[model samples]
Target: MGGGGGDGRSKELERLWAERDELDARIRLLESELETSSAAPASPAGEDAAAAGVGDGGCVGGGGACQARPGLAHADSLPADMIYRYSRHLLLPDFGVEGQRKLSRSSILVVGAGGLGSPVALYLAACGVGVLGIVDGDDVELNNLHRQIIHQEAYIGRSKVKSAADTCRAINSSIKVVEHHHTLKPNNALEVVRKYDIVVDATDNLPTRYMISDCCVLLNKPLISGAALGLEGQLTVYHHNGSPCYRCLFPNPPPVAACQRCSDSGVLGVVPGVIGCLQALEAIKVASDVGEPLSGRMLLFDALSARIRIVKIRGSSPACTICAENSVFTQEDFQKFDYETFTQSPMSDKTAPSLKLLPESARITCTEYKGLIDKGEPHVLLDVRPAHHFQIVSLSRSLNIPLSDLEEKLPMLETSMKETLDASAASDKQPSLYVVCRRGNDSQSAVQLLREKGFHSAKDIVGGLQSWAHDVDPDFPAY
Candidate 1:
């Protein structure tokens, strides 16, 4: 019966894979159609010249000869389809035809298609932004689906840039959706950012945030930045209208330990959704030259308390290396800036770093531990992950002692060891002490602490529970 159940699950997985492949093929076909349509004959040379104000640093369109507002430069009159599609927006007094026209002329580059970028791209596409560029090098994964709403279950294992661009095109196929299926580094950031009127810093890491902000400042583009983690979110518009850049506020990077990501801290899906929507709001406001944007002010959101607050942040600093008048931080310097080294943290958080605090003798592989378990050896499996994580998933009979409380619970650990040794009728012999965590890093630290406390036999599982799931038991949940 168990074998039959496994076979059924395998077949279901195969079917899902086939469906995902079909969906991918359809998306590619749609993208090709869009490209072909875009390549069709351009407007008359006179019209092209009049609308040539895009990307050349003039207004969105309104070449010197054109009299229409920057928004209306696309055409003397709105198209019939555009009128019906954006009727609600055109009805607004503040953002009527003029606002819609500006939006239609503006271009925005969203630098991450994850949680924040998902909503920003979706709303911008729906609002008829003339050109939207998505930048991401990661492939979709099951874990990203919770907060990264732009990606579907079928998009898993596909490029995030392609998935997000496809969704945006689906929402508004009239607009131009540019897919930059690569991570933005210092070398390519300037070239990618210069083409857009505004840049959105939807990226999650510090290095990328600083990199994007610096790029915007160098290229004279406004930046809409948003971040969310653990039921909290923040939004700010940097480098706009004499506002301070990110470096003006944070001259020094925060400690690596303090920079928690959604993966580590766990974000409520709606938190980023709220912040990303606000980011879209700010981008629209700035793009249309309408209501005030959140420049030099930070919006803080606390989902747990259901509170939203906007606070004034510092103005641009004279000493700001990149944005100040007297500063010499040029495009050349920006191209060569080593953001990871400056921030002392990696630019991407795709994987946790492996820790090697102990010698080979002090760590055991999951496979070796499985051997001991199969032989019915009397041993204690100590899970050093937090209590909540242990509750989520843990090996049977493993004791939970969070790494934070391990030192305080030394006596408890001693008692548990004593009990295990007595049960094995080997009280005189040292009890085997094996430590584990979600990953191997914390377990290594826990083992180091135990050894210092004279628990000489303490050893950590090399890759912790992740390796156990990968090697010893594929059925175990990794997260």
Candidate 2:
């Protein structure tokens, strides 16, 4: 009886497998039907230009001038590859052939090819945007690989735009990827922004974000902005019809010390990935006119709680300083604006006077510090990096007291050194305290603070461990 039951169960399993295969076949058929049904592409404003034999950059009649070929706006003549590629988009009523054609004609400029730009560029390229312009002056770093997914391990030292363009091209060879491998200062912001139909503020810096927003508003182009730091991210569309610019939402930046950067606070790789993809989706909605844009609304995402909420914002802010009728930034301002100096705190600023006040003797070079350690000289090496980083790869001779907690733990630092440190030293001048941080910037600040607290002999290791990795020890981990 048991043998008979086993045979019967096996036959039932076979029937279920056969049913699954049938459903899979039906899915393929439906996908093909959607593709063929939407084979008819609408004639966009650019179609007339292609028919008129306009040069790639010549007049495209009503759709402005063509940047590449007027290969967009395919009316009833969608390329065979495109039909297969955009099958899913074609199936959706919101983004059928008409929407795809619009996307094909649209050009978007993505600023800051970093964390947020990674997923945004990927999705937009794969979805078939005709032209993608990436602007970034920074180079890819070992630390950036965690969230900046577009750049790979091999691209550690390459310009971010070059790496980003390479990745986007590999994803979709049909689109044109332009690399602006220079900083977008006020001098060049207008020249670059005026060419694109839309701007994506993938930048994290306040100066660049404000610059991009102001430029888009001046050019009457829509802006899709997104930001992710730590586990939280925010997204919104700005400068659309009756929509408020970024200045309307944030007139001033948060205090620099209070502002949290991913380098300091840390970020889950997936957090920015999620926000970037959403930015792409909203940009697509604006470009293709498929759904209501995020203009006049902001989406807040909390990765910890896995929650997303959309809050309404005023379409126009009467008190908005920049976008208001009588505020600031006329079209000419884009040309003469001193964005670099205006937004950046000069090195001569009061807050950064540590290097000025601290004598040259208070800072030791990485090579000098290495010699001290080699001679078994008694000294306290205080690492002012985050505790998690110390756990990853740290010097055995160093003690971790993150810069933020250093002041409160000063007593611990002093007592620990007095009791146990420099035990084998020949002479006792009370071992000098030496500070180090990721890049030497924070280490200088810590040393300055220690000097003020009467640790006159305390000094910072110049260029921190980064210099050590470069000059003294190649095996020292950088990131």
Candidate 3:
């Protein structure tokens, strides 16, 4: 009787094990199907451009005759061997042979040869982009090696555009590398950008970024822009089919104080690496017409927490000082456009310094602003960082009125001051205006704002507070 019972139990266990194995096989099949479906490519645009019968040879429009025909440039077509070369892309459901041929026939211009540009150029080249035009005036530096991976240590101190072109060629010798060893300024931006199917902004400065955005918008070319600071970065595709240009999102240049540059503030070496990689992904999406590109959406990444946030940007602003519908930029206007004018401090005595100074004031660094309550500073710590940036890192006592917002928020300031004074009647001292921001530039602008508002005692902290922590106060966090 005991032997019979043991046999029944063993049979039941065998049945259960077989059922589990069958379920595992089903799961593996489902996962494989999901991956295959997700990797499928979307449809391509300019279908006629694909079906035009342009082969690996030069386009027929050129003033040259083919071996078999006279007065005709060889149709821009791919060779049979080239087709085999790009077979992996051709095998892709979305890219296929048609998309690979399209990429082989297309051309793109990349502006800047620094952090963002490095990854963009490398990926585009590796993807078999037919022609890549690089424009940059600066030389590679030792500091660039941290993020500018395209330039090797041996290439340091070499012209960035030249080095970048060499690197691109090394990756894919078939692709043409056009080098413009000059800056892309207002004068040359339109002309240079018009020659390519796409324009990429790998620039780090505000003026250059604005120039690239405006030129791409005017030329109706797609622009991919990316920027990084410390552990945070932002990227977006702009000026694609009447979508908002960069200026539409950020109308005028943020005041010098409000701009958070990697040079002044320092950045993690991997920040631009991550951001640039994303920019390259967007560029590839644009090139292949694959997944939806981040057009009109600012994709923000915080490396510290591995967090990504997307902010939808609206279309052109009617009041946008740069690219509004009514805005007209003529050749004459170019002469009057002063790039240096924006950097001038608003509190300069060149005007009326006397009227600029007024009543109560407080001073603090970006780092110290966090400890305002603990320090018991009797003032309001105003964040002068751009509103978008302020949202990323905000403190309890911080009130965000961007430097640009100052003109709009000025009138209410007096009432707020009075309320603060009333609230602190027991203290007898008037409430002071304490200005602070990331690194300290915007806070200086805030101090200037207070002076303009007739607040005399307004003073910006020395080294803006970042300096204070590094030099005067070792215990304070610099970031």
The model with the greatest TM-score is: 1
Clashes per model (N, Cα, C within 3 A): 2, 0, 14
Q: Write the per-residue lDDT of candidate 1 for residues 1-479, one digit (tens) a residue.
A: 68999999999999999999666545544543443345445445223322323312112222111122234335446654567788999999999988987787778899999999999999998887777889998999999898899999999999999999999878876676789989999999988887788888898899999999999989888999999989899999999998999999998999999998877778889888999999999999999999999998999999989999999998999999889999889999999999999988787875446879999999999999999999877788899999999889999899999999999998989999888988886567767999999878999999999999999899999988989999999999977
Output the better candidate (1/3) by lDDT: 1
User: What C-alpha lDDT do the candidate models reach, one value each?
Assistant: 0.84, 0.77, 0.67
Stretches off by above 4 angstroms in model 1 are 1-75
In model 2, the Cα lDDT at residue 118 comes to 93
Error of 3 at 190 (Å): 2.0
**Residue lDDT tens for model 3, 1-479:** 68999999999999999998666545534543443345435334332222322223311111111112322333344444455566687678977756666665566788888888899899888777656789988888887788889998888878999899999878775566789999876666666776677777887776667667767666667988899987899998887744688767766567666865665566888888888888877877786677788887889999989999999888667765556678786544543455435433221111211222223344444455446556766666566777666655555656677777787787666666677777774567877677656555566667876786787555564354456566556765544
Give the local distance difference test score of model 1: 0.84
In model 2, what lDDT does residue 70 have? 26
**Cα TM-score per model:** 0.85, 0.78, 0.58
Runs in model 3 with CA error above 4 Å? 1-78, 318-325, 331-336, 342-479
How many backbone overlaps does candidate 3 show? 14
Candidate 1 lDDT at 98 equals: 83
Q: Where does candidate 1 clash, by residue pair?
A: 71-101, 71-102
Candidate 1: worst-modelled 10 consecutive residues by lDDT:
57-66
Off by over 4 Å in 2: 1-81, 154-156, 345-357, 420-428
